[model samples]
Target chain A: MRRALGWTVVVLTALVLQSTVFAQIKLGGTKPELVYLVTIVLAFLEGPASGAVAGFGGGMAQDFLLNQPKGITALTLTLLGYGVGLLRQYVVTPSPILPVVLVGASTTVGVLFYGVVRFLLGFNPGALYLIKVAVLAGVYNAILTPLLFPPIRRVAKATRANKVFRW
Target chain B: MALRSRPRNTRLVVISLVMMSLLTITLDYRGGQSGPFEVAGRATVAVVGALQNGVSKVVRPIGAFFSGIAHVASLQSENNKLKRQVADLQRRTAERVSLERENQRLLALAHLEQTLQLHGVTATVIGESVGNFEWSITINRGSSSGVKVDTPVVTGNGLVGHVIEVTPTTSKVQLIIDPSSAVAARLSSSGETGLLTGQRGKDLTMDLISVGAKVFPNEPVVTSGYQGGLYPPDIPVGFVSHVYQAPNDLTKLISVRPAVDFSSLEFVLVVTGGSSG
Candidate 1:
C-alpha cells in the first residue's frame, strides 16, 4: 500500500514537472507524453496490473486536465502499457540494451496509437504530422530512458524493499 | 491461468481498438461523418476546451510572472520609451473614449446595420483550449450576459468566433482558425467568394475557390452576409497568407491568418443578434 501510494505521488509530481516546462521544452510544439512514458516504465517495473491501473489514472488525470474525450487517452495508454508488459517475454530485461530498445519501441507504439486514434476520430489534420511526432518522440524518449531508468529503478527498488524483506 | 488470460485478452483488445479507430476515421469521414462519433468528437472538443481553460487558469499566473520579469528587465532602457509611448497611449485613450461615442453614432447612422451591431456583455478570457485548439477561447461571460450558444463574438479586427456554450457566468467561443469553423467569406478584392475554413495551427483554409482564384497577399477576408446569422456582411476577418494550387487538386488551397490574434486576445464583442427569422 505504501509503495503504491509512493508511486502515485511520483507520478503526480512528474506530471506537474512535465506541465511546467511544456511551453519552453516542447520538441515540436507538443510536449513529450509523460503519462505514456510513466505507464510504460511502471509496467516494466511492476508488471501489468499496477501498470494498467497507473495508466488508467494517468489517462484520467490527463482527460480531467486536458479535456480530450473522457476515455480516449485513458483507454489507449492503459492498453499500450498492459500490452507492452505482456510482451515482456519477447524483450527480456535488467540489461541496459533492453531499456534502450524498449524506449524506442514504446515511444513509437504510443505515438502511433495516439495519432491513429485522433485521425480515426475524424480529426485527421495531416499524415505528415503523425510521422513527425512519432520520430521525434521515439528519439527523445529513447535518449531519456537511459537518463531516467536508473533513478526510477532505484525508487522502485526502495519501495519494493519492504515487500521483499518480509519474504 | 485466468490472470494470464486476462492480460493476453487485453493485448488483443488494444490492437482491435487501433483498427477500430482507423476504421472510424476512414468510414466516418467517407460516410458523411458518423453521428454518434460526431457527438463524441464534439464532447471531446468541449472537454478539451474546458481542460485548456483550467490549465490556462493554473498556468496564467506563471505567464504573468515571466511577463513581469521581462517588464522589469526591459524597464531601465524602456523608461524613455515608456514615457513617450505613455503620452501617445493617453492621447489614444482619450481619442478612443470619444471614438466609443462615435462608434454608437456610426451604429445609429446605418439603421440597416443597427440590427447587426454587437451588444457585448464584457467577459474576461479565463482560459484557452489545449494544444493547437486555437479556434476556441473560453470566457467568463455566458447566458447571464445574454451570450447564448452560437452568438457571434468579434474583436477589433473582425469576427473571432461564436459562443458554443453558456453557463451563468462563463462560455466558450470557437475561433475562426479551428479546423472545425467555416465562415462564408468573399475576397475584398475582386469579390471572388469562397468558404474560409480553419486549419490546424494558426492558419485557415479558404475552400470552394477555383484553381485560378485571384488572390493578393494581405488582402482582407470578411464574412459575407448569410441568411439567418448574427454576423452581417463585410466584417473584416483576416489576411491572405499563402496560395497553393496543388498540381492534382481541383480546388486551390489558400491560407488565411486571422486578424484578431486569438493567442493574445482579451476583450471581445458578443453580438446580441442571431437568427430569429
Candidate 2:
C-alpha cells in the first residue's frame, strides 16, 4: 500500500513537471520526457514486473492528461519499462555512467516506438521530425538523469520492492 | 521448484500487461473521447489539473529566473537595439497621432463599432499539452465560467485557438497552429477569401485564392465570419508572409505568420457572445 502511494506521488509529480516547468524549457523544439525518465529509473531500481506496471499507469495518466491520442504513451512506456527491467536483471553494471547511458538509450527507443505506433495508427508527422525529436529528447532526458535519478533512487529504497530486490 | 515457478509467473504477468495495453490502444482508437476510456481520462485530468495549477504558480518564478539567466546576453543586445528604436518612434509620435485620429474617423464612417466589443471571461494558461504531436494549452476557465466548447479564444493581437474540451474548472484549447486546425479567412485589402490551415510550426497556409487575385507579402488576413462560420468576422488572424503558385496553377498558396505568439501566451480571452457578423 505504501509502495503504491509513493509511486503515485512520483508519477503525478512527473506529469506536472512535464506539462508546467519543463514545457517552457525547450531545447531544439523538444522538451525532456520527465515521465519517461521516472518510469525507466523506477524500473531500473526495481525489476521488470514493477517497471511494466509503473509504465502502464504513468502512460495512462499522460494519455488522459494530455491531448495526444490515447494509449500511444502507455504502449510505448509499458514495453520500454519491461525491456529495461529485463535487461537490468541480466546485466549488472557498477559503472557510475550506467544510469546516464541507460536513460539516453531507453529514451531514444521509447520515442521511436511511440512515433512508429502513431504512424501505423495513421498520424504520421514525417520521419525526419520524428527522428529529430527522438534524438534530442534522448539527450535531454540523459542530461536530466543525474538530477532526477538520485532522488528517485532514494524513494525506491523506501519502498518494500527495493528491499526485496537487494537481497 | 518455487524459483522455477517465479519465472513462469513473471512471464505471465508481462504477457497479460502487454495484452491489456493493446486492448486499451484499440479501444481508444475506435471509441475516441466518447468512449469509456475518455471518461476515465477526463476524471484523471480534472483531479490532476488542480494539482498542476497550484504547482505552476509556485514554479513559474523559478522557471523565469533560470530562463532569464540563459537569455541575459541576447536580451542585453536586444534591449540596446530597442532603446534606439524607441527614440526613433518618439520622433514620429506627433505624425502617428494625426494618423490615428484619421483612422478612427474612417472606422466610425465604416460603422465598425458593431464588431468591436468582445465580452468574455479571461483565463490564465495553467499548462501545455503533454504530448509532442498535439499543440494545445489548458486554461483555468471552464464551463462554469461561461467558456463553452467551440468558443473562439484570442489574445490582444489575434486569434489563438478555440476550446475543444471543457470540464467545470478547466478547458483544453487546440491551438490554431495544430495541423488539424483550419480557419476560413479573407484578405483585408482585396477581400479574397480562402481556407487558412496550420502548418507544422508557426506558419499557416492560405489556400483556394483565385488565380487572378493579386496578393502581396504583409497583407492582413482576418476571419471571414461567413454564414455559419465558427468565428466572428474581422478578428485578426495573421499577415501574408509569402505567396506561391499552386501546383495546378488554378490557385495561389500564401504563407501566413500568426500575429499572436503561441510560445509566450499567458492569458487569453474567450469570446462568449457577440455578433459573429
Candidate 3:
C-alpha cells in the first residue's frame, strides 16, 4: 500500500509538472516527457514488474490527463518499461552515463513506437516529422535524465528498503 | 516449484496488463468522448485541474520573472519603439476622428456589432496538453462558469480554440494548431473562402481556394461561419503569410500565421452566447 501511494504521488506530480510548468518551456517546439524519465528510472531501480507497472500508471495518467489517443501512450510505455527492466537485469553497469544512454535510446524507441501505432490507426502526420520529433524528444529526455534520475533512484531504493523491513 | 511459479506469475501479469491496454485502446477508439473511458478521463481532469490552477498561480510570476530577465535587452528597445508609436498615434488620433466616424458608418452597414457583442466568460489557463502530438490547454472555467463544449475561446488578439470537454470546474480547449483542427475561413480583403487546417508544428494552411484568386501577404483571415459551422462568423483567425499554387493546379495554398501567440497564453475569453448576425 505504501509503495502504491508513493508511486501514485510521484506519477501525479510528474503529470502536473509536464502539463503545467514544463509545457511552457518548449525546446525547439517540443516539451520534455518527465513521466517517461521517471518511469525509466523506476524501472532501472526496481526491475521488470515494477517497470511495467510504473509505465502503465504513468502512461495512463498522461492519456487521461492530457490530450492524445487514450491507450497509445499506455501501450508504448508498458512495452518500454518491460524491455528496459529486462535489459537492466543483464547489464550491470556502475557508470553514471548509463541512465543518460538508456533514457535517450528508450525515449527514441518509445516515440517511434507511438508514431507507428498512430500511423496504423490512420493518424499519420508524416514519417519525416515523426522521426524529427522522436530524435528531438530523445535528446531532450537524455539532457533531463541526470537531473531527474538521482531522486527517482533514491525514492525507489527507500521504498524497497521499507518493504524489505516490513517483510 | 515456488521459484518456477513466481516466473510464471510474472509472465501472466505482464500479459494481462498488455491485454488490458489493448482493450482500453479498442474501447476508446470505438466509443470516443461519450464512452465510459471518457468518464474516468473527466474525473481525472477535474481533480488535477484544481491542483493545476493553484500551481499555475504560484508558478506564473516566477516564469514571468525569468522570461523578463531573458528578454531585458530586447525589452528596452521595444519600449522605445512603443513610445515612438504612441506619440505618432496621438498625433494621428486628432486627424483620424472624422475617418473614425466614416469607418463606424461603414461598420454599422457591415453589421460588425453582431460579432463584437459576444458575451464572454474570462478564464485563466491552468495547464497545457502534455502530449507531443496534441496542442491543447486546460482552463479554470467550466459548466459552473457558463463554459460549454464547442464554445469559442479567444485571447485579446484573436481566436485560440474551442472547448472540447467540460467538467464542473475545468474545461479542455483544442488549440487551432492541432492537426485535427480545421476552421472555415475567409480573406478579409477579397472575401475568398477556404478551409483552414493545421499542420503539425507548422503554420496553418488554407486550402480549396481558387487558383486565380488574388491574395496578398498580411491580409487578415476571419471565420466564414458558414451554415451549420461550429464557430460564429467574422472571428479573427489569422493573417496570410504566404500564398502558393497548389500542386494539383486546381487550387491555391495559403499559409496563415495565427493571431494568438499560443505558447504564451495565460487567460482567454469564452464566448458563451450572443448573436452572430
Candidate 4:
C-alpha cells in the first residue's frame, strides 16, 4: 500500500508540473507529455494490476484538470499503461529509444481512440488537428524518455527509510 | 507458480485493463459518473498540484537564475516581442486617454455606452494542456465563476480561445492556436477578410482569401464581428507568418503567428457576453 501510494504521488506531481511550468518549456517545437511518460514508466516498472490502477487514476486526474470530458483520459491511459506493461517483456534495445518508441506508439493509439470517441460523440476533432497533436506528442514524449527513466526508476525502487518516495 | 499460470496471468492482466478501460469509457460517455477510483485520482492531483506549488517556491529562485542564463538565447526574440508590446501598449494607452477625453466631451449630448464589457470571467493560467497537438490552458476560475462552455476568451492583445470545461475553481481555455478552434476574422490593416483556423501548434491558418488578395506578411488581424461575433472587434490576433500559394489554386493559405503566446500564458480575460450592442 505504501509503495503504491508513494509511486502514485510521484506520478501525480509529474502530471501537475507537466501542465504547469514544464508544459511551457518546449524543445523542438513540442512539449513532452510528462504525465503520459510517467504513466508508461509506472506501468512498465510495476505490473499490470498496478499499471492499470495507476493509469486510470492518472488519466482521470489529468482529464479533470483539463476540463475535458470525463473518462476520456482514463480510458486512453488505461489502454496505454496496460499495453506498455505487456510490452515490457518484449523490449530488447535496453535504450531510451525503446521506451520512447513504445510510448509514442501507445500514445498514438490512445489519442486515436480518444479522437474517435470524441468525434463520434459530436466533438468533431478535425483530421488536421488530430494528426498534429498525436504525432507531436509522441515525438516529444519519446525524446524525453531517457531523461525521465532515471527518476522513475529511483522512485520505483524500494527504500527502507523513505517510504514516501517508494513506489 | 507454473508455466500454465503465466499465460493465465497475461490473460488476467489484459482482461483487467480492458474491463477497467471500458468502464471508464462508459462512465465518461455518461458525463462524469466517476467511480470511486477516479475520485481518489482527483484528490491525488489536487495534492500534487499543491505540493508542486510549494516546491516551485524552492525551484523558482534556481529557475530564475537559470532563466537569467537562458535569457541570452531568448533575448533577441524577447526583445523584439517586448518592443512590439511596448508599441502596442502605447497605442492602447493613447486610445484610452483619447476615449476618456471624448467621453467627457460627449457627456452633455450623448447617451454613450461604457467601453465593451467582457463576455466571460477573468482567469489566471495555472496549467497547460499536455502534448504538442492540443492547445489549452488551465485557469484559476471555473464553474464557481460562472464560466461555461464556449465562452469567448481574450487577452489585452487579442483573441485567445473559448472555455471548454470547468470545475469549481479552475477552467480550461482552448487556445485559438489549437487545430480545433475556428474564429471568423478580418484584417485590421487592409480590411480583407478571412477565416482563422488553427494549424499544428501556436500557428493559425487564414483561409478563403481571394487568390489575388494583396495580403502582406505583417497584416494585423481582428475578429470578423460576424457569425454571432463570439469574439469582439479590433482585437489584434496575429501576424501573417507564412503564405502558401500554389499555382492554379483559387484560394491561398496564409499562416499567422498569434499575438498571445499560448505556451506561456499566465493570465487571460474571459469575455462572458451579456451586453447591449
Candidate 5:
C-alpha cells in the first residue's frame, strides 16, 4: 500500500513538472518526456506487474491532465512499461551506461509507436516530422535519465517489500 | 508450479491493462469535448493546474535568472571584483527589463484592444502541452472568465490560437502552428481568400486559392471572418513569405510566417464578448 502511494506521488509530481518547467525549457524544439522517463525507470526497478500499473497510471494522468488525446499515452506507456520490465529480467549488463541506452532506445520506440497510433487516428502530421520529434525526444529523455534514475531507484527501494532471509 | 504461475499472472495483468487502455482510447475518441473522458480530463486539469499555477509563479523567476545569466556571463568571467558588481547590476537590470517588457506587451494589448474595439479578458499562460504531438498552451482564464471553446486568443501583435478546452479556472489554447489547425484567411492586399493550415515545425500554408488571384510575396494575411466563422474579421494572421505555382497544381502555393512568436508568448487576450463570425 505504501509502495503504491509512493509511486503515485512520483507519477503526479512528474506530470506537474512535465507540463510546467520542462514545457518552458525546450532544447532543439523538444522537451524531455519526464513522465515517460519515470515510467521506464520505475519499470526497471520494479517487476513487470508494477511496471504496467505505473505506465497506465502515469500515461492516463498525462493525457487527462495535459489536454492531450485522451488514452493514446495510456496505451503506449502501458505496453512500454510491461515490455521494459520483461526485457530487464532477461538482460544482465554491468555497464553503467545501460540505463541511458535503454532509455534512449525505448523512448524512440515508444514515441514512434505513439506517432503511428496518431496517424492511424487520422491526425497524420507527416512522417518526416514524426520521426524528427521521436528521435529528438528520445535523445532528450536519454539525457535526463542520469538525473532521474537514481532518485526513482531510491524510491523503489524504499517502497519495496521487505526481503526475508534464511540462514 | 509457483514460478510458472508468477509469469502467467504478470502476463495476465499486462493484458488486462492493455485492454483497459484500448477501451479508454475508444471512449475518448468518440466522446468529443463534452464526453465523460473530457469532463474527467477537465477535472484533472483543474486539480493539476492549481498546483502548476503555484509552481509556475515560483519557477518563472528562476527561469529569468538563468536567462539573465546568459546575458551577463561574459562580464563575470573577466574579473572577480567586477564579476560580483556586474552580477548585482545584471540582476537588478534583468528585473527592470523584464518588468518593462511585460509592461510594453500589456500596453500593446491595450492599444490593440482599443484599435480593434475588442471586449475580452486578458490571461497569462500558466502551462504548455506536455506532449510533442500537440501544440497547445494552458491559460489562467477559463469558462468562468467567459473563455469558451473556439474563442479567438490573440497577443498584442496578432492572432495566437483559439480555445479548445476549458474548465472553470483554466483553458487550453491550440496555437496556430499546430499541424491540425486551420484558419479562414484572406490576403489583405488582393482580397483573395484561402484556407490557411499549419505544418509541423514549419511555416503556415494557405491553399485552395484561385489560380487567377494576383498573389505576391510579403502580402499581409488576416482572418476572412466569413459568415459563421470562428475568428473576428481583420485580425492579422501572418505574412506571405513565399508564393509560387507548381506544375499541374490547381491552387497557388504560398508560405506564410506567423505574426506571433509562439516561443516568447506570455500574455494573450481571450475575445470573450465579440462577434467572431
Candidate 6:
C-alpha cells in the first residue's frame, strides 16, 4: 500500500509538471516526456510487475489529464516499463550513467512504438517529423533523467516493504 | 516452489495489465467520442486542470523570459519589418474603409451576411500538450465560461484552432496544425474554394482548386462558411505562400502560411455565441 501510494504521488506530481512546466519549455520543438521518464526510472528500481502497474497508472493519468485519445500512452508505457524492468534484471550496473542511457534508448523506442500505434489508428504526422520528435524527445528525457531518477529512487526505497503485511 | 510461483505471478501481472490496456484502446476506438471513458476522462481533466492552472501562473513568466531570450537576436529586424508593414497597412486602411462600406451596402441590399458578428469569451492559455506527437493547447475556459466543443478559437491575427474537448473548468484545443485538422477555405483572389488540411510541422495545404482558377502567391484565404459548417464566414486562416500545378494534375497544389504564430499563443478569443451568419 505504501509503495503504491508513494508511486501514485510521484506520477501525479510528474503529470502536473509535464503539462504545466515542461509543456511551456520546448526544446527542439518538443518537451521531455516527464511521466515516461518517471515510469522507466521506477521500473528500474522495482521489478517488471511493479513497473507494469506503475506504467498503466501513470499513462492513464496523462492520457486523461491531457485529454488525449485514451489508452495509447497507457499501452505504450506498459510495454516500455515491463521491457525496461525485465532487461534491467540481466544488465546489472552501478554506474550513474545507466539511467541516462536506459532512458534515452527506451524513450526513443517507446516514442517510435507510440508513433506506430498512432499511425495504425490513422493519424499519420509524416514519417520524418515523427522520427525527429522521437529523437529530440529522447535526448530531452535523457538530459532530465539524472535530475529526476535519484529522487524517485529515494522515494521507492523509503516506501518499500518494511513488514510485508503492514500497509 | 514459492520462488517459481513468484515469477509466474509476475508474468501474470504483466500480461493482465497489457490485456487491460488493449481492451481500453479497443473500446475507446469503437465508442468514438461519447464513450463512458470520455466522461470519466473529463472529470479527471477538471481536477488536473485546476492544478495545472495554478502552476501555469508561476511558470508563465519564466517561459516568456526564455522565449524572449531565444528570439532576442531577430527582434530588431522583426521590429523594423513590422514598422514598414504597419505604415503600408495604415495607407491601405483608408482605402479599405470605403470599400468595406460599399460592400456592406451591397450585402444589405442583397440580404446576405458578409461576415459573422462574433461575440467571444477571451481566455488565457494555461498549458499545452506534453507529448511531442500532438499539437494542442489548454485554455483557462470551459463549459462554465460558455466554451464548448467545436467552438472556433482565434487570436486577433487569425484562426488558431477549435476546441475539441471541454471540461467544467478548462478546454482542450486542437490546433490547425494538428494532423487530423481540416478546414473549408476560400481564396480571396479568385474566390475559389478548397479543403485545407494540416501538414503537421509544415504549412497548411489547400487542395481541390479547379484547374482553370487563377492563383497567385500571397493571396489571402478565409473560411468558406459553407452551409452547416463548423466555422463562420470570413475568418482569416492563412496566406498562400506557394502555388503550383503538377503535371497533368486536376488541381493546383497550394501551401498556406498560417496567419497566427502558434508558438507564442498567450491569449485567444473563444467564439462563445452570436457567430451565426
| Real interface contacts reproduced by model 6, as a fraction | 0.68
Candidate 1 on B87-204: residue-level lDDT in tens?
Answer: 6445544574454454455434533235455555545565554332234566766676688877887765677888765655567688777777779888888687788887665578
Deviation of model 2 at B52, angstroms:
1.7
Instruction: Quote the positional error of residue B154 for candidate 1 in Å.
Output: 3.2
TM-score of 2: 0.88
Q: Write the per-residue lDDT of candidate 3 for residues B1-277, one digit (tens) a residue.
A: 6655755666676777788888888898899778888899999999888888888766655554444444447877656655654454445435543543443343344444344765566677889887888889999899998888899887666778899989999999999988989999999988999999888857899999998789999999998888888877787888999998857789999999998788777657788874345
* lDDT of residue B149 for candidate 6: 93
Which lDDT tens digits does candidate 4 get at residues B20-122?
A: 6667556655655356544544454455445545554344333334333444467777566556655654564357435334333332122212444434455
Clashes (candidate 4):
7
Chain B TM-score of every predicted model? 0.63, 0.81, 0.82, 0.68, 0.84, 0.83
lDDT of 3 by residue, A1-167 (tens): 66788888888888887777777666677878777888788878877778888898888888887555578888888888888888887887799899899998889889999889888877876888888878888899999898888777777766674433100
Q: What TM-score fits each model?
A: 0.64, 0.88, 0.88, 0.69, 0.89, 0.88
Which pairs clash in the backbone of model 3? Answer: none
> DockQ (C-alpha) of model 1?
0.17
Q: What is the DockQ of candidate 5?
A: 0.58
In model 5 chain B, which range of ten residues has the least summed lDDT?
A: B63-72
Angstrom error of the Cα, residue B68, model 2: value is 2.3
Ranking by DockQ: 2, 5, 6, 3, 4, 1
For candidate 4, the per-residue lDDT at A125 reads: 66
Task: For model 4, name the residue pairs that clash.
Answer: A133-B133, B119-B271, B119-B272, B119-B273, B120-B270, B120-B271, B120-B272
* Model 6: CAPRI class: medium
For each candidate, what's the DockQ? 0.17, 0.62, 0.49, 0.33, 0.58, 0.51
DockQ of candidate 4 relative to the true structure: 0.33
Give the Cα lDDT of each candidate. Answer: 0.63, 0.80, 0.79, 0.65, 0.81, 0.80
lDDT of 4: 0.65
Off by over 4 Å in 4: A1-4, A65-80, A87-167, B1-3, B19-71, B74-122, B189-192, B210-216, B242-252, B273-277
TM-score of chain A of each: 0.84, 0.94, 0.91, 0.83, 0.92, 0.92
Per model, kept true contacts as a fraction are 0.02, 0.63, 0.52, 0.38, 0.68, 0.68
